[model samples]
Target chain A: MEAIKDKKNLQVVINAGWCKSCGICIDLCPKGALGRDNRDKAVWQYPDKCIRCGLCELRCPDLAITLQEAEEEE
Target chain B: MPVKRYLRQRFFPQLWCAGCGHGQIMASLIRAIEELGLQKNNVVVVSGIGCSSRMPGYLDFHTLHTLHGRALAFATGVKMGRPELNVIVPMGDGDASAIGGNHLIHAARRNINITAIVMNNNIYGMTGGQSSPTTPVAAKSTTAPLGNIDPAFDLVELAKGAGASFVARSTTYHSKEMQNMFVKAINHKGFSFVEVLTQCPTYYGRKNEGVSPTEMMKKFATTTTSIGSPKKKENPELIERGVFVDQERTEYASSYCEMINQMRKQK
Candidate 1:
């Protein structure tokens, strides 16, 4: 997670405002690609590891974390 | 973002409590429909009064927000009237088992082709945390001053025994399994029932177990086992998850149609 200074392709968008920080997505992430940040918001700790399985996307009750194509080109 | 296509975006910020699992059930239902490539217009979500019943208000579909604990009856009418449409009813524990208990039994007995998702949070969350039919013995609730003394209904067993053609149980923590079950329930031909366990952190958890949402979810993850797992024999406390009953039977609506046709021919 510390190595994820610059996130790349396939970003996980966490609508932190509605999130309960329940960690269902974190536990369901097949690649262990997500973790909660200091703000208790779900963040793609290692986006590179994500396989776009969408387990987190389909299962989140809050609709908090949605898988999206990386928004930024960087 | 894609799932937004199935939601009524104008209804953003649902009224459910922050940690309520209704949102997860909604997401899973949407994903299941998406996976099945179902047309939104062809799907009808019928719900009764309760926190989970509010799902139809947010989802973009032909919906009926009906009386408390009467969703199955209304859904039965809708399905019988238009057999082509997919009718899905979302009910809370009290809504399904307590007030509408007779309807639940009759619906299963008739084997009407409809899907019923019982969101069993075990407490009447919207009504100030009174113990519901699914509330386990010894659980504390507003109505259960000291502790709940009455035994809870084993919903899966009840559905199976009552003649549901398809029955399954899964929890909010196990999203993948739940989504698969929802899809299966929808696809099944006869009356399909899926009981989804959810965490009522605002009510049940706080008052009964005093655990946070994450803690409650973890408890579900650890306490549950697959229906066929050998661990079930050793740990009787483990709630078994997965499909319990699946059988092919002539659906009531179709049979009624055929009966009418036969009578017309005889005349």
Candidate 2:
């Protein structure tokens, strides 16, 4: 049951190659779950804080990000 | 339990396609409502037919899903009947500036106490991608197979000319800015209009030159410059976007109510 909850945890995947770093996703994130990666690319700095708002995924200029709620491992 | 509960239409998943900007706009609206600390009972969300019109159903409030292009008309009635309620009309480009154009103009003209949030995805998303009055000239659509020839209506200018008490424009990509605008609109005492330039990834994507919703959002973010100056009149492209206008003037309902009260006192 714990594994399932962990699996279902929300995660944001960022493809740095496609990221434009416009900061739109960063600004719009209601929970402040995102921040810049090592290369100044947008990343999910704190995945646990994600509310799965999808603003980052939706506003990513380069289609570089995807958001998924991890499924629980039963 | 929290004082505010979710009252929007749950049956309808985010109606717009994946990556569509409408979702962001909807989220911004909900956030704005929460930020304002409004009681759900005192707020009513009304909508007309179109993608954006589906908004009222999803919000947990007194919702009215009315006829196409007539949201403002119905909202006016709601506001008049219950002057204390915060009435909000969320509509699409076609529903607001096209089929419902007349109502939109008159509502602003009347300065009715309602917040009109026009989600402008440019083309009509529902009922196929038809060219709307706000579709940029030469932009392709399902109906406009070879690019639209008609000039688009500048809603900000139109609202200003029509005498709206508060008028502003922001794109869905600008979530924080758009949220701030919504907050202002709700707080304003009179007719407040906000045109949110959104993205229709499915229909509008294949039709227009833009590819994805993200690209469209980036275009909106880059192409439009701030209305603030350095006041150098750059090329027309630079002047296309941003908060073009904001003004505080007489609100219709308050003034009208005052007049009626004075007359009653005199009698």
TM-score of each candidate? 0.91, 0.77
- What C-alpha lDDT do the candidate models reach, one value each? 0.89, 0.77
lDDT of 2 by residue, B1-267 (tens): 121255333444444565666667776777688889988899999999988887776678889999999989999888877889999999998899888999999998888889999988888888898889888888888888988899998888898898888888888767778888999999988889998888887788777655655567777767666676443365555634454445666766677778989999999
Best by TM-score: 1
Instruction: Compose the digit string of candidate 1's lDDT tens values, residues B91-152.
Output: 99899999999999999999999999999999999989998989999999999979999999
The 10-residue segment of model 2 chain B with minimum total lDDT is B1-10
User: Over all chains combined, what TM-score does candidate 1 have?
Assistant: 0.91
With candidate 2 superimposed using the best TM-score fit, by how many Å does residue B104's alpha carbon deviate from the native? Answer: 0.9
Give the residue spans of candidate 1 off by over 4 A.
A1-8, A20-55, A72-74
RMSD of each predicted structure: 3.5, 7.9
Q: How does model 1 do on interface RMSD, in angstroms?
A: 2.6
TM-score of chain B of each: 0.98, 0.91
For each candidate, what's the DockQ?
Answer: 0.46, 0.09
Model 2: chain A TM-score against the true structure: 0.74
The residue ranges of model 2 lying beyond 4 angstroms of the native Cα positions read A1-74, B1-9, B229-232, B239-244
